[model samples]
Target: MSGTIAFGLFAVVFVTSALSGVFGMAGGLILLWFLLLALPATTAIVVHGVIQLCANGSRAWFSRHYIDWRIVAFIASGGALAALGLALIDYTPNTAVVSLLIGLMPVLVWIPKAWFRFDASRPHHALSCGVVAGGLTIAAGVSGPTIDLFFIRTQMDRRQVVATKAAVQVISHSIKIVFYLHAALVLSKGQWGMVLLAIPFAILGTRSGNAILRRLTDANFRYWTRWIVTAIGVFYFLQGLWMVT
Candidate 1:
């Protein structure tokens, strides 16, 4: 990447990291879109995995007091199995398909809550979501909306929701990085350095976002988060259609 592009990406990371810090999801999807403009799909996925691993890790840590360890454990167990299964596969999905699925993810919230009544408090439900979310994150490069869906029916407050989701993403993204590395997706020294540089910005963004998050009422937060994610999902759907066409 050129110096100009690298600097631009740094700015993007800072801004998006803050967004994710507040919303718990949208930033990664937005970042992946920008990355696809500059890197091959496989390379973008690997780099995204690394960047998000750090971003979500920091978010989880910052909100560690609110994290639900039981949820994380259940999800991690299923995610580990999913990652191993994906690693054994010789084939990956085409980018268009993954993009389409991502596009449709946010809209899932519009479905009637009664239609999908998995109690997130149950370990089985969390494990099932983890398995599906793990596979989707590997294939699509972002699956935040899907993960968010699992928590919708839970009794968690906003802080707990964000913290727990961040923890689950940490596990998912870590598995993604390992699977890509196993698949021989090597980054250039410059790319690796860029990823490292992005981490601090991501951390800063998360901190700023958390500060902002503290001010929002739960109702307003949910309202804004849904719309923002929905808008991004539409963009992803259109982008996927354009790619396939």
Candidate 2:
């Protein structure tokens, strides 16, 4: 690869990982975009999942004390089912379809809360939520908001909320990586360099984001996450359109 491409990938790793920690969702859509520019779409998905599993897994582990085990178990179960289904399917939708769906999610999640003043709190059904999160995650790589919306309205405290989300994501992402490997989506030894090169930047970004979050009030974090999600959704939407054209 050219020097420019390598540098660009490194930059993306740093910025997206940092953003992920502060925002509660890891940067799958963004990461996928960068990887697509460098590799085939299928290979890009594999690389993205593998890198994210390593990077975000560390972040979640560092915050393991904050994790909710029950949530993790439920989400993992569902995500595994989704992964299996996706693996079995012969034909899947194109990137544009996935991107557009991802773009719509932020608005779908926020409009009810912001305009209707709706509190979507209902009883937690782990199996049901897990299935949805897993299926969408496999299809679009942007299920964080779905999972977030479910938990945020549950009257959970800030730390527990973040922790639970992290835990669920860890399990979900881990399953994705495993399934991808089994499906032959992951790269072999030749591609390991790029993946390894991304690690330091991701680590640095995670630390920086965590430091910033420490000072923010709960209300501030909420407002920040909502706006960021909206911006990210628009990003995916526009990128999807560009990809198709």
Query: Candidate 1, overall lDDT?
Result: 0.85
Model 1 spans > 4 angstroms off: 182-185
Candidate 2 structure, TM-score to reference = 0.86
Instruction: Point to the candidate with the largest TM-score.
Output: 1
Worst 10 residues of 2 by lDDT: 115-124
Q: Report clashes for each candidate as comma-separated counts.
A: 0, 0
Clashing pairs in 2: none
What overall lDDT goes with each candidate model?
A: 0.85, 0.69
TM-score for candidate 1, please give it.
0.95
What's the CA error at residue 195 for candidate 1, in Å? 1.6
lDDT of 1 by residue, 1-245 (tens): 68888898899898999999998999999998888787767678888888888889999999999999999999888888777778788547566776798899998767678799765569999998888888888888888888887887788888999999999999898888777774334667787787789889989999999899989888887888889999999998998999999
TM-score of each: 0.95, 0.86
Q: Pick the candidate with the highest lDDT.
A: 1
Error of 2 at 64 (Å): 1.5
Candidate 2 residue-wise lDDT, 88-174, digit = tens:
884354577778878877875575655533222332466667777877766665587777767766666656666677667767766
